[model samples]
Target: MFWLPLLIVAWVATGLSCTRLCLTAYRAARPGATPGQGHELTLYEAAFLSGGPTRVTDLTLVSMARARRLLLAHTGWATVVDPVGGDDMERSVLGAIGPGGQSPIAPVRRAAAGTDAMRALADRLVTAGLALPEGTWSGVAGAVRQVRAAAAAVIALGAVALLMPAQESRGEAHVALWFTLALALNAGCLAVARFEIHPYPRWASPAGQLLLSALPARGGSDLTAVAVRGTRALSDPELRAAFAHQDTAHRSH
Candidate 1:
């Protein structure tokens, strides 16, 4: 009897939390009544939507290096070969590179992501419904972890109930078994969440993802494709290495 209230409260609270988050994310992703404008997202926009600002930054660096406007050294430093930016995004990338036209690529990336222009681009993408709301992925992931932790807590509560000094009763045994049911339900919730989120991109809205997938694959003659497609798509080992090293340095933090 003592443990019943505890078990009911814990399971109910966790269930409600998970359900609410799942519903909110789903509603946010669902297409609107009027539908999207079917706008063709540019490569940089696609990269930003799919992988966030980091992907766009990497693509920009790679594109500049390929065009001989920037020298991406084996040592991970980016030296600007061209001080004149052709457009606003290029100017932002160049500015992030610095007035001296040389700095470590990692810092350039951080600086670029923080730029006012970059923030504006992000706002445009969200307004167009091409990008996920900021923090959605992390929030969903956190909810999953919270539910799993609640499952564990429920088990602990059940164990404590079983170990308490009391007259042996079927009612007490039922309460513990009920905890097992709660654990099983938690497992089901986790499975569903995983399935739902696996196809959901980190920064792109579901509509954006669909369009990105339907876009023509990068071709040999598409100069713009290389920048938007990302550094991983590059054939140059050194360029990929520079980006890889930067990625590693970030992960270590």
Candidate 2:
């Protein structure tokens, strides 16, 4: 019927969209086929690429607190014991503490996450193929979700088209052809979409992901041990809290 063609069109459109989504997810999940020759990322860089700006700030706060350069009071305030910083990231963190050199952890985290220095650092990591570009990661995640939702929508529409009262009397002739094709299309899209979804932690190619899993924790005194447990986990409770505070800042471009 006329409606059958329209439903078929809808199904085809959705199937095509789903395919695009799957491709995007795959590209984001595995940005490149080849991983960097050497895994030489600094602890902070690894944390940033693995977990984004939030993790970077976490490492910074923990490092400063451990080094006695900043006091991360248990009461959620940061007081700079020393104003000097060794790098741009550290300086960004100190600036986040504000001109007074003291502020609540949440505001400080927000500010630090928003700094140009953070973007430069993130870009450097991406250039080394250690991190996923921010836009690419967000696009992939959104596309993955859209594809999944489209799968369901197309299936529902196809089901309605097939099971309609008018279609019931149409016999097994076209019903089998149209219905089966629609169902197959929807099912295939859904299955592929599921398989293409990537990990939510951060962007890493498949090879880099494997390497990240195999990478060891940053080892030093108790401080390094506390900030980074390993490539996969964050060790410090305070640092973890900093993640909760990141929605306020941390621009991505």
lDDT scores for all predictions? 0.73, 0.64
- Over 1-253, each residue of candidate 1 has an lDDT whose tens digit, in order, gives 6776778776886687668657755754565222256566676787786667777777777767778998987777889998887667778889998888788888888888988777887888877777777777777766777777877887887788777654446766676677888878877777776677665456777766777776655343333454346666667888878877777877887
Off by over 4 Å in 1: 32-38, 165-168, 216-229, 251-253
What global local distance difference test value does model 2 have?
A: 0.64
Using lDDT, give the best candidate's number. Answer: 1
- Model 2: weakest 10-residue lDDT segment is 244-253
TM-score of each: 0.86, 0.77
How far off is residue 217 in model 1, in Å?
4.3
